[model samples]
Target: MTQHLHTQADLDRALGELTLRDPRLAPLLALTGMPALRRREPGFAGLASTICGQQLSTHAAAAIWARLSAAVTPLDAERIRRARTDRLGRLGLSAAKIRTLKAIAGEVMKGHLDLDELAGAPADEAHARLIALHGIGPWTADIYLLFCLGHGDAWPAGDLAVQEAIRIAFVLPTRPGTKETIALGDAWRPWRGAAAHLFWAYYKLAKAPGFAAAPALAPVEAGTEPATKPARNPNADRRSRPEAKPAASERLKRAKP
Candidate 1:
């Protein structure tokens, strides 16, 4: 059976479990409180939104989706598949994105890619199936699992915000790569989805007023000069090297002479 995170209770449980597994999350929890449960209706609309959101800013995605939704008139798989590319472009979808959207719509219409079936499937299996389709990657699949199907343990380790949050939280010298993020996320298993939410929450809060300087985890970068430079000696450039102090043996020799 597919377990979905529907209530704040689910989020609370996940947060508690995640805290127990990774104490580092405690600081973020204190700073950001419980993360918002970003749930989405599980179906074509959700998948279509994910497709529309690829590489687009939040406002841009919302605008494009709004236009497309209005133009599609009911916005079903068949309509999307039959819609002209130029029409979709006029709705603000790039040609590449239009192709991907149409492909997704066609698959769904043909019953080859059923979002409902995916909703009940294991996260890994569902994720694999999603990525097997054109224009879908690990990040997209993980987003669908977390937000759409509400897979409790879905972790989008490749997400840039999550990586940055991990870097700041862990005090790493640099942002964790996808592999490193995945390894780090493994400790929050069974609640990785919530962990992902927490990271995103922290990412947002850390950028807000008063929290900008909260990331004191890592040391300053290497090769950074001190805040104040030493005063320069104008004659130092022409001055000869200072004489070295004589050793005990040399002093004795000079005394004997």
Candidate 2:
């Protein structure tokens, strides 16, 4: 298999390649610097954490994960499988998430899913296996490949942060859907995962101190093209009121089973 980005040097190489591939990203890269590679070891516990984090904001996910981690103490597949439903439920996990979490843990414990070997598998092969599991969707599978497996080219087209960041950076009149996002991501091959990290960093930096919240660009409707003009809200003044909107996690909740 080709080398995955398992080190800082690997990530640097990917970013450098990205800059050469598309100099348009140079300005955004300069603003954001090298994006941080948020790597996670391949294991049942880390995957379980991803399950728990579904549909929740980063802050909220971290909080719930903290509680679950503390409760389980040594959160392993067996531990999670054996944990009482009431206890897990008390940790603020929704009923659906709890069931999904247990199912994933059970599958791993039963040797039905070997995460280590899976990590080494090709991205398409790995994604096929992951999405076959209950409650795990494309978004979850892509995240697993991108962060857990460190797959160099993994890109989560379904991610709203990525869509929003692209809207802001490209100055698109609207956010691109999965098809559009994938097409746009074609500009950055092999380093698409790094591109994802850069977009997340850009999302934060764009909303950094003194910078206005990036305009809430609407997604272009199906079968129709996006308007050339930026979306306008005549009722509220753009300067005074930062159009009150749902938090990213809230507005962009995962499609949980």
lDDT of 1: 0.72
RMSD of 1: 18.6
Give the CA lDDT, 0 to 100, for residue 103 in model 1.
91
- Kindly report which residue stretches of model 1 are placed more than 4 angstroms away from their true locations once superposed: 1-3, 212-257
Query: What lDDT score is found at residue 75 in candidate 1?
Result: 83
Candidate 2, residue 243: Cα displacement in angstroms equals 34
lDDT of 1 by residue, 101-220 (tens): 899999998888878887676556677788888898788888988998888877787899998886666555567667667655545665778989998998887667776434433223
Residue pairs in clash, model 2? none
Off by over 4 Å in 2: 209-257
Provide the TM-score for each candidate, comma-separated. 0.80, 0.78
